[model samples]
Target: MTGTASARRSASPFSRAGVLGIVLVGFAAFIALLYFISAGDTGDRGNTGAAHASATGLNGYAGLVRLLENEQFDVTLSRTPSGLETTDLLILTPPLYSDPEDIAQILEARDYLGPTMVILPKWSASGPPNNLPAETADKFKDGWVALGSANTLQWTSELPAPFALTQKIETLEDDEVPQWSGLDQSGEVPTKTIAYAEQSALHDPLITDQSGHILALSVLGEEDSEYYNNAHWTVFVVEPDLVNNYGLSRQENAAAAIALVQQAGYEGDYSAVTFDLTLNGFGGAENLLTLAFRPPFLAATLCLILAMLSIAWRAFLRFGPAAIGGPEIAFGKKQLVSNGAGLIVRARRFGLLAAPYADLSARRLASRLGLIKHDAEAIDAALAVRLPEEEPYSLRADRLREARSSTEILRAAQALRELEGKLAK
Candidate 1:
């Protein structure tokens, strides 16, 4: 029975290990959640037939992005406002209904970076709303848009000063279609509706029709003006179909699109292309999730992970034994005294111990001093003669015998033991 209890005691009945395991597991799950939140860009980028770069819809420039990537130019689809502030050539494909001020803000930021291309919208495309039955919604493939009639952007004149957009969409006769040419490549615009921004002194025409209305043009100004003296230039694509997915099926159009991207994005030995998605509603604000994984904060994140690992290791493995427990029923003099003390405590009999403990100390001291008579006066006189500096044994024993609380009894008993020791010395 004793061996059984000792074996049981060896492995703690309390679940110190189990509780620690729970804590470590909880911490790991919390870190995993934080990582998931911060791991990727936020927004719904799924194809809903929008004209942004991420969409494969006919009006979208996704094919243009793919062509740039295939041509080895560094291409990025930016969903944050920060993407606008870069030296790389930025392509803006803002929706017709978007705020002109937002577009102005982007251009103002890029004044130092230099060069941007604004593609005005022409096609009014739409997809079936999801409120329809799921079975019907599933029938339509992703990014499929029903092409509506080409419409002119009415709000283009509301842009920043010195820019006024008077755009026209003309449909030429069957045998009268001539290609627009620039950038050493030429491509035919769709005859059903050919779009152009009316020529003005502010425009430097890069691509144009036979009549010479601007299909694509660079912003121009006086020699000393910032537009002319800035690090690069800005071009506007009046026609949406020139580089959109609708025109990409033709080899000539595809080649022309490639040349246009290179010409616009070119700066140094090598230049990259970036497509803006913020205006198309894919933008996300910078928050804790974004900051934690960047810069000085990234170092802090790694340190936090290391701390968690160290704590888990400490919890999983023991460096030293906690304690070595004794048997259920121990033997010998020490155990006997411990058992007696426990009984006295349980019965509230602390006062009963004082008198007996002092009596026992007196007997032991008398025996040690080689005294025959153990009367109170005799023993005290002997102690006085033997150790003059010590308090007499009779006084210490009387204090011990009268003590009611455990603290008083312990102090009185200690004095008697010290006197006995000094006399023997």
Candidate 2:
């Protein structure tokens, strides 16, 4: 039984079928879960209607729509020109690339039912913010009164970059009057500086005059007396990088911008926010397409996929059989002793001691019987007669009991040996 157990312990699996079976089962479960999460319309889709963008529903906007919603702004997601009507203040985030048609639509509304905010992101040749043409650049300078440059940071504040580049948020001079009233934790307040620029990236004057009304000034724009006057308009243009999700989440730039928008006195606060590329643009083509085509569905699908993959990897891949080594042995001294005795008996070395022992026995018996030449038979007979069971062999026993030195002992033993043979015959 012990040997059987040892053999089994030493045995390896005959084939990999068991391992293969486990792999298949795990893979099946993984695929099933992946399909399930990605299949049906997941709730991760965009919300619909007025309730959707009303802080109640997060329908639209880029770079954290929830931030606006939390502040009781009528934040909505809209991509159509018609959807622009939903908000008085439209804060276009960075990463926006404008076509002529899009620019035309923006210009049409610039005069009256204006967007309170227009934020241009850092443009890169290869990414979400596509590089703008000189025409578009001119429009940005004349229209928004904002500019772009590398992000800046300092020991005193948390801006995204380390050096000053473009104007992000600008603070008005102490003597300048506010262009509008804004809310604070203390309720309604009056001030040109709703918040300080995360870094001092803003140009000397933040407002400019292009088409009569006070517009934002570009960071790189030339200084003109007309743009510096206080009564025209109040603009806070943050460094583009300072207002992104990574930066805004940490600093007060995002919150401050929201406040500024409300102070500008727009009707509703709804916007369809997307990067020039959608959220999916950050990953694979599938994700980009999904975000572009069906953003809500894609969002849900992604969530499910990630969840399923994590669970499957943990539950299936982490499990396996432990390895075993060689067979073992138990101990036994009694069995070893018996085996050694058997080996000695089989060697038949007892004859080597018997001949010498017989001669010695004859000599010792002779001495005991006072017969120096006595043999074994003589001693046997004497003892038997004295013991009273063998009188007939007494005389023979007496003669055979004589033995002298070692040679004599051997001779006497041989004579007794012959007598015993004659008696047996």
Candidate 3:
């Protein structure tokens, strides 16, 4: 049994199936750990509803995105606030329920970065209501409800200079469409009557209704206003309907929206156009791990990863072959006794074996003395008669039976061994 167990333990530790299973399990665990770490602290941002860049609903700007892409413009739907820090045109579409002060702060933060176009919210929309069945809701065509002036006014009143909208909605008459200020006329304009705005002193009205109320306005940067300064421009579109999905359904409306984007980029480059989604509550907050790998700490992160991989590689290459263990058990009865004693010592159970060993020693001493049918009391009497008077053998035998510790048991065992030697003589 000992030899077989030793051989099994000495066998190769590098079985192909075992190594493959360990590798697979380790890889799966690593992937799961990474996913758990990344998914831990993602903030509350739901990607749905109107004005969201990816939303395909009626009020979504997906149509505008497609149009820009078709025009060969590099359009990106920016989910994080950091994306606004670019030299491209940044378009912001805040929902009707959004706080105006928050919008103002975002604009102020991105003011000097590049040109921005703020599209005012016009519709309040949502998914089908809970009261409707899923099948019925899926077929529901009307999801957007137009917001009243009170709601629109509250949001507009919170914006900073050259960004507010008129409380009164100005409607364009049939056959009336706002034209780009410097661009020449081309085709029969779409008769889509939409809302327009009135501007402040800091704004230059670029597009106007027949009554001349500003439909679209341009706000130039302080440096851009001067002769040679190369600062980008900012634009404000009062009504979002003109460029949204419902508006862009007509070819003429699409043309007008494209012209607006071009106009915003007139000062510099129109190569890239980005729509902001941070304001709509998507990808607003970032985790600490993401920040660590971003800019200045990227080198440190790479070094850490490389160091870990190197350590793992070194450990893998360190194992050459299994070492041969010697014969399972040593020879001889003395060896067996030594092994038993060693086991008792390691187990710290000397006191437990003391009584049994003492009793067996007494029995053997009796048998050697030619005593027959000797009980423990008879053996004790015989030991008392034969042993020295000073150290009583019977008393020492009782002490061994009552021994409660390894030291006490060791002394009792030694006394028994001495008594046995005397009896053998």
Candidate 4:
């Protein structure tokens, strides 16, 4: 017994406090990792598309976004539908293949919310092909596209009631300088062809070219609540080159672009101008992984992290004395006999148990009373000296030996066991 106590305990490689420190630090680091990953990017590819606010292509309007930002205006690239309903200015640059109903639905919802500007797509743009020459590929810039051809949107001609529009492309020669006048500013478009909307009786013209073709149109809602809640102005830019990156290259066009955004949808000094990207397919949807690190849920996530740290602490520092592992098999005659009895029981030999149990009980009682002879009568005489009121051991032994049925054998064995236990006591 002293051997276990006398041995010196080997020092643990890490103490309990050190282990707790490691667990807390590791948990904090894991939480930091999740937070950073969730907050880094909403999976929006930078300046990759041809016409979205995030793109830098000639047909894209990212330059306009930068220009507005430089002018101290709050500009946002909206990836969700909720951003489209801002009570300020919302700019939409939907692709050519976009659904007209979807566009109409967005406008219908935002009728009372804010002023919206729809700059229709004009150029069919694409990236450099795989068969591009090395010199040409080297010249190609990232997020820059090749302007293939000029076109018009089908929805422009099928706008909501009393707002029908149609467009005709006009090719400009190198010598021809077709100037546009709008927003009290004049600018010459930088593209080879200018797509201008034809005359429409339903809408008022904001900007017109030298040919009097409408470059921009503003549909005003009647003050009557049946037609509209208020006098809302929905500006439509037919030729995107008037405000696209190619158009913004000219200082005059840049000024005109900013004028169109501010004068048309001016809300307040700090009212935001939201540029939509969902129609161009850069939408950020709700997700469990993202929500866990965001507001409201972040508090619960932190609580869970704390609970984990507490669990680790409880496991590392134990209470009371350390319990040494016990032997796999207990060291006792009872266990040895139990193994033997289990084997005997498995053999289905009930008759063999009664005689052995009686003999064993007699020997145990005889040894306990210091009797030399282990016979049933001798054990009975010795046990009677210890306790005179007990049943005779010889009588119990005869009954157990003569037992034939399984029930009689079990009953006799139980009686012998009880008698031995009383003598032992």
Query: Which numbered prediction scores highest in TM-score against the true structure?
Result: 4
Deviating ranges (above 4 Å) for candidate 3: 1-49, 126-152, 165-167, 172-193, 221-232, 266-270, 287-343, 347-359, 372-425
Per-model lDDT: 0.76, 0.39, 0.68, 0.78
- For model 1, what is the alpha-carbon lDDT of residue 263? 63
lDDT digits (tens) for residues 1-425 of candidate 2? 66665565457553355655776798787666554343332333332111112112111234446676666655554433344443355444323332434433443443344443444333222211237676775543211222222232222122121112333334456775433212331111132322233223333334321111122322221234332332122233433322334334433445544544554443223333322112111111222333434756777877877897788667554344334445443248976767655675688443343355455555655565556556656667665654455333334334334443445545545554554443333
Report the C-alpha lDDT of model 4 over 1-425, residue by residue, as the tens digit.
44553332223456667777887799777766665444343444544446978778888888999999998888998776668778878899989877778888888887777788899888887887769999998988888888787876677666675445787888878888888997799988786588888776656787888888898888754445443446456788888888889899999999888887876675243357899887887665544467877998999999987997688768876622354556767778999988877887889788888877887887788888898989877777777788799788888889999999889988888888888787666
Those runs of model 1 whose alpha carbons end farther than 4 Å from true positions after fitting are 1-40, 43-46, 128-140, 171-179, 266-270, 286-290, 293-299, 315-397, 401-411, 414-425
Report model 1's TM-score to 2 decimal places: 0.67
Greater TM-score among 1 and 3 belongs to: 1
Return the candidate ranking by TM-score, descending. 4, 1, 3, 2
Model 1 lowest lDDT segment of ten: 36-45
Q: What TM-score number comes out for model 4?
A: 0.71
Q: Rank the candidates by lDDT, best first.
A: 4, 1, 3, 2
How does each model score on TM-score? 0.67, 0.27, 0.60, 0.71
**Considering lDDT, which of the candidate structures 2 and 3 is the better prediction for this target?**
3
* Number of the candidate with higher TM-score, 2 or 4: 4
lDDT of 1 by residue, 205-276 (tens): 778877776888777655577666773666788877888988887788888777666666652333677888
**RMSD per prediction, one decimal?**
7.9, 23.0, 8.9, 7.2
